[model samples]
Target chain A: MSHADPVLEIRNVAKQYGQITALTGVNIQMFAGEIVALLGDNGAGKSTLMNIMCGALPPSSGEVLVRGEPITSLHHAQEMGIGMVYQDLALAHHLTVAENMFLGRELRSSGLAGTLGWLDSARMDRKATEEIAHLGISTLRDVRMPVRLLSGGQRQVAAIARALMWSKAALLLDEPTAALGPKQVALVLETIKTIAAKGMAVCLIAHDIPSVLAIADRLIILRRGRIVRTLPAAGQTVTSVVSMMVGENDDAAAA
Target chain B: MDRFRHPLLGGNTLWVLGLDVLLVIIFQLASANGAFLNPINVQAILTTYSQVMMLVIAQTMLLGAAQIDLSQGATAVLASVVAGTVLVSMSAGGDPGPHITLPVLFLVTIVVGLLAGVINGVLVGWLRINSLVATLGTLGIYLGTAQVITNGENLYGVPLSIQSAFGSVYLWRVPLSTLLAAVVVAVVWIQFRRGSFGTHTIAIGSSEKAAIRNGIDTRWHMVKLYSVAGALCGIAGAFDLARFTTTDIGGHGNDALAAISGAVIGGTSLFGGKVYFFGALLGALLALILQSGLVILRFPPFYQVIAIGFILILAVAIDSFRNRNEMR
Candidate 1:
């Protein structure tokens, strides 16, 4: 890695809810300019691992570090440059796309107006427009259009763009392509690739094997609350990945 | 669909405003002998409209965040009672300390309102009680508290001159209360259009979970919203004493419903995240016009209450229809 330090690192992280161990002994690193895909079946700890990494849920043990500095809370995680697009997008559908992008971190006008909490709407709209353009996303035309009006893929792009604006080290996408059409899926993959080329570490948690194979540079597969494999994705196929993910094929071969 | 813009407020304000004007014109034309347009009737409507406008302003913000406060009227009644009782004891009832009485009375009234609001906020925001139920419970408690304070009798001995000064005075042929209401509306509208609190308020109402995930302290913010509503009710209570110079302990029972009717009739959404302050003003005005015009046309006064119920239902129906069709 160019920086010699991973953008994000989770070391010996484990999570438990009562007697249910959601994740155990999870260790992962994401270097800048890298795309890491987290794959697993339902209840396999993919979501738990991602939640801990994003600092949305605390791990029972271990630490989440951004640029080697431990993150304390979700707010701290964000402050230290960990951004995430939730599975549901967590967008305020009644607000415009630009407003959602800058929600809770709005840019206010200078001087007294700012102190009084008056927003610089022009500046925010301009900033959002500039960010969208800088990301090279052409699907969304209006920043002022409420998120409720955007297509699913466009909402995904907007959420990604929002995360990108505040994130300096890593972007964690939870099922970014879930429920999108094939063409939209391709668009999202291309967008992820574009973001990775910009040197942002991307951790993609997705269920679609082929889509994961096509976009992810590395695969980390988990089963029954523990990671089973960490393999490079340069020459992996959908069938091979699927067998490893389900874990039954390995048992059959052993038998 | 394309018309929605502005970061803080949006939606069809002009459409609602237009309807308000049409309602006024129809009233002006239909009332027997144009009585609705007569200066005295007009004056009476403007005064009562201004009086309830305080609660309307409060209810607008509450409903804009998808919250409801059924105790605004009760809160006002209690505030007025406490403040009036204190003023009478302090001033010995003659003009009630002319210079200091009104200000102090108003302050005490508002603080009580604010305290009542904080209780509601704590229940809803901290304890996670449903807002409607919380406020409804507080309504009973607050009204009961006022009744207990006065032994179910309206408190007398308030200075009559308060009515002459703050309640009935006219600066430019309009009721002094009307002018004061205008100032309040103007100040609040500007803030709603440009302030962070206003933006965040809508954000929370639009989707509380989304707002919380985005780093907004939805729970804490809810406390502030309810507090503001309560404080406004305090001011309305002060107005109650100012206008009538007596505690209307039993009179303002319908204030909450009237205010909600006005706010919803305006463009503010009952589901939260949408607010148009001017639209709310117009909505309240429409209700006033409907009630007053019916009176002039010699319709039974009970029919006015029925009209209000019908109009409130119609407004919600329209809002629901628009919401269902707009969202995919």
Candidate 2:
């Protein structure tokens, strides 16, 4: 409702896996510089939606529009600048933070008629270090240390960092705080806030009601492969959101 | 030593070192003579190891990236024949062709080897064929092609000048070919240790699904990796043919198996992820030493095969345990 011009618009999207319907007539709009959390139970179409948006899966019907244009090709996905970070973090455990940050988008120096390509490690390291500092992740001190040496929280942060470094448009994070301890969850929430402040749109999927309340600017609840409700953060409580998420009547009226 | 705890050089490095120590001890025990430790014999061992070591080095790079090129040995054999036949035919038919020039011949042979590798890459990387099956198929294709070229005829009296430069020449008692092997090992080690290639390679092998989700261009990376392996085999083939002074038909039947065994013994894991180039170097050396020890022990050539099999199995077992530990 607060959107001026929606950054992403999913118009009547539907997806099916064999005989099972994963998502049905799901419609949502995401705006820039906002943290929108999708709340759902297990297999409630939360992952299906993110997968469709991230180019991991194709919708059976309808369209996904970025800046009012539908995505139809791989180049469209890359050009739209949407990035995804899965629950596994996808941070190469063998690679250093700098290497992971610039994994795909490596900058190489021009050699002999522009034929010899060499990676510019110095520049990549400097940029990765700056990004790490900006995230307020002090535990990740050595940019050269492999992600295997990193804690769960640091690995999550690094995955996000890779996304931010590669693409500037939108980030779709799936279960970003799942399996994290309380302290790590709080740190991730802070990182989410910082990401939004940088004018980047974030779509976070979570099952935890308290976590959504902590970081989300708005919440979209999906039940049985359909959008049930969209609520703003102002004047919202966990009780109301939980009832809405589970398809139960809100207690606000009786209270 | 705990001084280094890299994914590549962890407990696996210790395993490689232990194997080396064991091989040396076995060599000493089997020989029971001063000849085994003689510098001349050592140099001879180095010379012999240098040839297979080239193939092992290439195998290590591919294996590092969670790939294996079964056709590398066959490709080397084919290159040797191609270089020898083309040069001999050109010289005999007169024109002292550019193809016979050392640099040009070397480049052409490598290019031929690269073409063979590219075939495997296209099948495995582009067509998304299973690497083992794809390379296995090409292994037969390349070996068959080599046999056809030679037609069971050995090419002798190869350019003596070429032989002297690459084969007979030595710098302060060290063969130039051995120096070349040293350079290859050093370069690969730096790439794996100081560069970012190993990281990406290991990640690909560790879990292809994970690598794809992380935004890696897995297919393209694999193609490039296979090409590198091919180029190295091409070079090795050219060198082996030039040095051996004759192009023997079906000379590389055991090259692939030997290189793979050497890599495993050097602590490279077949399940992918993790590469130890120097360990591969040590592994190749151990294999060579064992062969020499067998000769000194007056064992048959068939026994050497059994020894290699045992070492390969033992090394793979140790590597698997190390892999499980690291995963935890």
Candidate 3:
């Protein structure tokens, strides 16, 4: 992992709101084929960190790199193979799954028909099925079905699939399992593991500690705008992770 | 399934079509002299409503993007007035051949109409004003501007040949004007069905934030849509001039409402994210067929208005109930 450059890196990043300091002196590096869960309590700057990493918010100071190259905008970050799936998932329910998947970059027919903006829907539907199938997501059987008809877990999977299909390097998800049942949490967690195992970096801000712990290879704990600990997830109890997240571990260290 | 379900089969479209067919049948049977089905009367209805369909198509396109254009009628009126003024000045001595004059007239009218849309797009999309208020405001400005151009008098003295060639001429016993409208409608209908532009529009209407997050420049898309809708209204205005050989500024007070009602009553949701153009045709037809049938049945002319008001309410009630059931 050390031999290859990190897929995403945040160095000495800081953000301030007028007189208030939201985040300061943050550093993080995510390598390929890794699932890192961002564990934080309320007001722990996880959202701020996620926003900065996704280029939605700019850090007051420091560098963010994707594949050793700097990102100028959120669109640029997407271009540089960094994808973000928001907590809401942001899928258009009115469109078919395949249509939503290829919303902005739809395949067009060749030559003048393409110039006239004719869509190549057959290719798009086939490609959507292929991508979802490639990720081993089993529930989505019909690409032509509108997204509104899908269950919560299926929609979540489709949203993640869209992000992964577009971004080649890293996936940043804000609360992937925040609004799901036990079964859907497991499904999404399993999907994240499959994504990581396929040589992609997955960083997720997780409110549900156990679900993240079940699949995340590493846990990055954030407290009061700073990352207090970066620890391996293996054998870390929810109680321990929660304590670290709330700064009890820092108090213990200072003592 | 509810949102992008085939616009043709969804909501009240089939019922509206059935109502239209039933109305035509009753009108034909009830007319004193087959007046409702008479070729001349049918041709008049076809030519008249075909123009109204242009506005319905325009309004439907705007509604697809979660936008509205109250100025569609005003734009059409202003376009015809301005184009008529230009045509009168150019043809003062001898009418230039219809080939040269008609195209120019159409071009000027469409351009004026396009400019009206750009103003609305800028206000709503770039300035970020609420579309309802913005279009309502433009409706007044555009209509007032047309009123000022003609000073409360309709423009006249347009070239007669323009009307002769396109307005009165019918091929295969059908009005040429209606066929032209048909061709335009068919092209736009197919584009909305198969083009990226249509999906982009519906996407924006679905969730503007979602569309923007997916890298759609929704503001620019708004501008393009309003401009396109405006151009259609312009074409409608040009056809109006070609048919009447004059401007009718006072004649189109109900056009915007009619178009919006046509779109809504047809199947395109007032809330947006649906492009039911054919449903809109049926919706607009509901009024035209009712009115013409009333005329042939010897009912009062204004009775059609009250009847249309009732039908509009009935259409909305049915749609709301169906939506609730579907949700369940």
DockQ (Cα-based) for each candidate: 0.61, 0.31, 0.55
Note the chain A TM-score of all models in turn: 0.96, 0.90, 0.96
> How would you encode candidate 3's per-residue C-alpha lDDT over B266-286 as one tens digit per residue?
878776777788888999988
**Candidate closest to the true structure, highest DockQ:** 1
Where in model 3 is the C-alpha error above 4 Å? A1-4, A249-255, B1-4, B7-11, B325-328
Tens-place lDDT digits, model 2, residues B158-270: 66656766676678888777888788766766655544455567778766777776667788777777777787788777777767767756667778878888888877777
Please give the ranking of all candidate structures by lDDT, highest first, separated by commas. 3, 1, 2
Candidate closer to the true structure by DockQ (higher is better), 1 or 3: 1
Candidate that scores best on lDDT: 3
Report lDDT (Cα) of residue A220, candidate 2. 86
Which residues of candidate 2, in runs, are more than 4 Å off?
Answer: A1-5, A11-26, A41-44, A55-81, A109-116, A181-183, A197-199, A233-255, B1-33, B93-101, B156-159, B186-199, B213-215, B299-314
Q: How many clashes (backbone N, Cα, C below 3 Å) per candidate?
A: 0, 0, 0
Candidate ranking under DockQ, highest first, comes to 1, 3, 2
Interface RMSD over true interface Cα atoms for each candidate: 2.5, 4.3, 2.7
